[model samples]
Target: MNFQTSFPSLRKILVGIHDLGRKMAAGADLSHAFIMLDGSYGGKEIASSLVDEDPNSPKGMEQLKVRKPPRQISIIRHCVNTALLANSAELDLAMGPSRKASSLDGQSRFLPVFRSGSCSEIGPKTYMEDEHICIDNLTDHLGVGADFLSPGAFYGVFDGHGGKDAASFVCNNLLKFVIEDQHFPTSLEKALKSAFVMTDHAFADTRSLDRSSGTTALTALIFGRTMLIANAGDCRAVLGKRGKAIELSRDHKPNCNVEKLRIEELGGIVSDGYLNGQLSVARAIGDWHMKGPKGSTCPLSAEPELQKTTLTDEDEFLVMGCDGLWDVMSSQCAVTIVRRELMDHNDPERCSRELVREALKRNSCDNLTVIVVCFSSDPPPRIDVPKTRVRRSISLEGLHLLKGVLDSNG
Candidate 1:
């Protein structure tokens, strides 16, 4: 049963061992030799063993005589096999043989594997909330004497609650109100204030509220050299400037200092950290029920914090969203994702659609709305010069001649 007898000569032995080593290195399991040699070959198995057999020697030792040199070579070969195992392990680790090991830490890696090239809704969620409106237009006439306003003059995120009515009203009428208000100030500051107040008044009389119909208002009006933002509700306005998030609107929560004081001052208490223990609006357009009694100063007031800053070329875009979208995604995260989409497709609407889709995929339950206004468009068209209608001509020639004759007489 001596397997070694199969290859008899020294040259044959060397060739067989070398070939076996090659096969082993080529991924053959070589460790089976020890068990096969011991179990299958007995004392009388080999001719060499039978001739030199000592019946008087210790049981199995007399039958086995492995030379020291070959044994050492076998140990080295096993070590080479061990090294190969270690290298295989390292290769597996480096190459990430499994897909799970290659994923990123955050949501970026989990962006839905889009089925169709066109952006579409994943669930029941729509890219736009029913209550929100977005408008970006080039003004026909620039406001200033010499400098002209960019055609991109408007951007809005209307967040409606208790129903989409308030948001819908603002979206439909906000721009028109601003345009028609003779009282609207020439400066963005005045214009924003006028627009917000007028929008609130416009909302008050639009429809009757059965439940509690109210909305968080966040609007951005871009004019020459200025970016003006006004916000009243939980909806947010964020500017992505130089790749960072600059929050333009403050969250008017019941727990906030100013909001808490205003709610309490109006004979309302923050119950469980919510206004009257129900709503969280410190300032909102509607909620006539929460307005408290007449002659009360604490009614739901539509005061908005107006912010204005001179926009620079570094200002990439503005993100306006309802609290639904912001609840899951950080302002910077939204900005980063939207900016990436815009840079890839150069479309603001696509960016908006994706922003909402990502929010919904993140498990946001509320109505999600997002608007991205990119200020990259053709310059506004020129304004028409005012026409002058001359009714009467001044008698400048007679006056000049009379002055000349008087001087000559003198």
Candidate 2:
């Protein structure tokens, strides 16, 4: 029978059969075979196959022989179609399209899709002082109403200074505070601010953790189709959008004008590019040793500045990393490397691992932590845009005039 033209839906079944045959040829043992044929058609068999259940088969022995019955092919076709339909339904549920692509102002936009991966490395640092978190579904814990805010995701990278205690504490408890705040599930900005301040104060009150240790916090919270990013230190967040890198957080370096002014106004100094000649970041969490008396304001604040934008299809993924990665690679360079790796393997975890490896190759001396949150099921597709060219020519008359001026000067 010409199964190719007569039964187009059986293509996958045939391919599966071919694969099974290859496995059998490669020494796979089969234990049983069952064939059911219509008894109404004189009990004629439509198909039959032999299986060797013996475990002690000799080399090159024939274990399977498929027999084609003289008639009743219709029974075989019906069985195959039934099996194929079941498999097709499963495949549709597992690998079906989940995102809707739209357009906004001539640019492609996609609804937010939740898929994230993370990787961290000690690199050349004496200890792993960096930490990160990936909450795939915040609503699962927050129990927020859909009308107030749809289910969301969160990614954060913390870079510790002085020690790892602060980093560890914040990594484990920051999200908890954020969700438990009274304003949570409604006002994310207010909730995030209160969480950071509360976490900082809580750490300060703790006598077990190192009081002098601090960590830079950078977080990306995705609620529905909107993304809200907040940062309180040198840790960074960069968005990969249409093959370009867009920074979402500013590094809180003491040299920055705003940081410098804030530090000096709080009776602090930015001497030798360091805040108060000690810390390098002007903002952080759990640097209680550098802060003023409990109620008074301090130079090294834990308040994070927030940036919010609606996510679109053009936004590929977000890279949240410690300063260790940024120390050796520019944001665009990191994005380019990750984008290329994602295109090759479509694995965000692998892409983040590659970023850490690249930073190590460039001689970064700090602990590295990176989280990549993809906005779609797969990595962003590469688009090749044509470059425009311009040509300019000088007229003969204009050339003669130029030559006359040169000759007169000579």
Candidate 3:
């Protein structure tokens, strides 16, 4: 068959396979077949297969569906590998030789090591209500390379409201709860979810902690090449890739439609863009005063929405910061500043400091905390290309006409 002519179809098939792999990894029932391939590719006959099991043999298929833990992990890894390979192949075909050559140069290089830096400032706020944590080596405390566990990094930014107690408590105890969860390292999503709930409950149980105080949480956990982000409230996490800013977390504000619906459903009201006219954030760690009765759900939920994405060569760095920075600067603007700083200084710490400084210069009123996590060993190298300006030579007749017009005007 002519592979070049069938490339597009082949790419689509690979994408479908990738999607199926992800579904299987997520524990979706695979007994029922959903995909159908009945058409010909490059004049070659294609076979069709049913993904669903036979109606008469449901019990047999059910028995086969019980996968062992190791097998499950293997399937997920295989799916991820296949998807990456397909994507790389598609990219290669889409790019011409010149583009491919450029990719081989330093312009498309991937980092060999991961480094992180953080800075926090009590801006115009009366107190330092923002807290952050950076764990370079998560495995230092957890054993190295256990079954599903791999060495990774943990980073978070907690933006406090009402008081600093909630932020401080979450910053100190959240990671502990994540690592200690029964699903740690295996099912990352479960581990993170359990960790958030556990942290909320732990804070609520503390008699000394102020129940009226609360804080928004944004966390990024990098395990191997996979990233899992959990966010509650308005703090944000942005990823820098190829000079572009990609947001990894969503702000949980009271005005958001989804949040407003949930709040009203729970018999809570939003007034002037604040939850119950008191807190601007719809979700948080401690505001026990706004919660419903014990064992009952509340409009002000502590639950966080999670996001997952895999790291690639194109990914550069990640910026986690409180809303103070975002209030004055956009995600792309921040990425541009950080990229320029990294290029000039080759220092993530300095880059973060510059971000905080820029936010203060813009007149942010809240406390600010910024974390810059670089995927490279050193700050990303500056790619300096000379500028090309277009110039045109004037004809003799045109020049004479221009001179005549100038003389007339004078």
- Which candidate's lDDT is highest? 3
Off by over 4 Å in 1: 1-129, 138-152, 206-212, 292-296, 377-410
Give residue 243's error in model 1 in angstroms.
1.2
Between prediction 2 and prediction 3, the one with superior lDDT is 3
- What TM-score does each of the candidates earn? 0.56, 0.67, 0.67
For each candidate, the alpha-carbon lDDT, in order, equals 0.60, 0.75, 0.77
Question: Tens digit of lDDT per residue, candidate 2, span 274-387?
Answer: 998888899999888788766568888999999997887788888899988888777777677677778888888998898889888878888889888888887678665445
Q: Write the per-residue lDDT of candidate 3 for residues 102-213, one digit (tens) a residue.
A: 7666543443356889999999878888889998777664565533445588899999988889999999999989878999777889999888888988888989988789
Q: How close is candidate 1 to the true structure, as a TM-score?
A: 0.56
Candidate 1's displacement at residue 89, Å, is 63
State the weakest 10-residue window (summed lDDT) of model 2.
43-52
Q: Candidate 3: which pairs clash?
A: 32-51, 32-52, 33-51, 33-52
